[model samples]
Target: MRLFIAIELPDGLKRAFAGLRTPIPGARWVPPEQIHLTLAFLGEVEETAVGHLHDELSRIRIPSFKLRPAGTGCFPGRQRARVLWVGLEPEPHLRDLAAAVQSVLLACGIPQEERPFSPHITLARLKLPAPREVGLFLSGEPKHAFPLVPVREFILFQSRLSSAGAQHVPLHSFPLT
Candidate 1:
């Protein structure tokens, strides 16, 4: 199964981001329901190994913390932006939690993510190289500061890709104490 671990966004925050979707040509906006802060992406794991993964993840212990969206940016740098996203304020606890998740998954024989952990919610996928308008939008000061929301739990999700875009199914949730 195609799997990943992420923290689900609160309803209020989801609604707030939903309103930020402007009509940018050649960009595909992510649906609010699918918005999440991913900790790790484990691609194509065997069914039998899922049980081990679940067991290890259930033992994760971290204190709950609050997070808020800060500014807008894109992947592969602003000049060659491909994925538009909203940046999250750097929280040490958040990074710790993500590291713990990666450690456990690695012990379970899953390949580690080569890229450094960058916490952001993908807003849209640009079809062509990012246009001047996208740069302009991000250049402005953040129009909104998302309300701080509690992070009480993280979930393991199964991703099924289709023509309609990826469908994320929550398989299990791990609570933060």
Candidate 2:
């Protein structure tokens, strides 16, 4: 089964995310319901090991915190962009939470992600040669600041891939207290 751990956004806030979408050729916009800040992406895992993953994750006890979308940018490099995203304000506690989650995954014998954690909400998937405006779009600050939202919990999501796009389903939830 394909799995990942992430902080899902509230319904109203997700609608606000949808409001930011713009028409860009070859760019695929993510549905508002699928918008989330991923903490860890555990590619594909055996069905039997999922139980251990859940057990270890439940032990995590971090205080809930808030986050806000700050600006827009593209992944890899704007010169060769593939994924467009909205950056979040720097929050030490958010980083701590991600680290704790990663630590547990490692203890559970799951291999660590090669890339360091950089939290952001992906807005679109771009196909190269990406439109020239992708770089231009990210050049300035966002016209307005998105409201702050609480992060009371995170969920272990199962990603179902299909011809259309990936659909995420929450399998288990871990609360912060």
Candidate 3:
């Protein structure tokens, strides 16, 4: 199954992001319910290995922490942007939690992501490279200051791909103290 580990956003944050959706041509905004901060993207794995993955995840122990949606940016640089995302404030605890999870998953035989962990909530994907106006939009300082989001748990999610985009299913949840 195609899997990933992520932190679910609170309803209030989702509602706030929903209002930020603008009419950017060729950009497909993510549905609020589907918004999440991915810690690791574990591509397809054998179904039989799921139990082992879950076991490793259950061992994670970290204190709950607060995060705020800080700014907006894009992937592969703005010049060739394909994804637009909302950045999260850099919290050491957040990085440590992600590192712990990735470490365990690697020990479970999952391939490690070469890219460094970047904490962000994807807002949309552009069919083509982002336009000049999109760049301008990201250039401005974030007008909205999202409330501190208390992250108490991270989830192991199963992603099912379809013509309608990907549907994420929470297979298991591991809580932080």
Top-lDDT candidate index: 3
Off by over 4 Å in 2: none
Error of 1 at 90 (Å): 1.4
lDDT of 1 by residue, 51-99 (tens): 9999999998999999978998888877677898988999888998999
Instruction: Estimate TM-scores for all models.
Output: 0.95, 0.94, 0.95
Candidate 1 TM-score versus the reference: 0.95
Q: Which lDDT tens digits does candidate 2 get at residues 98-174?
A: 99999999998888889999999998888874657785677644575788989999999999999988899999999
Each model's lDDT comes to 0.88, 0.88, 0.89
Q: Candidate 2 vs. truth: CA RMSD?
A: 1.4
Clash count in backbone of candidate 1: 0
- For all the candidates, what are their Cα RMSDs to the real structure? 1.2, 1.4, 1.3
Total backbone collisions for each predicted model: 0, 0, 0
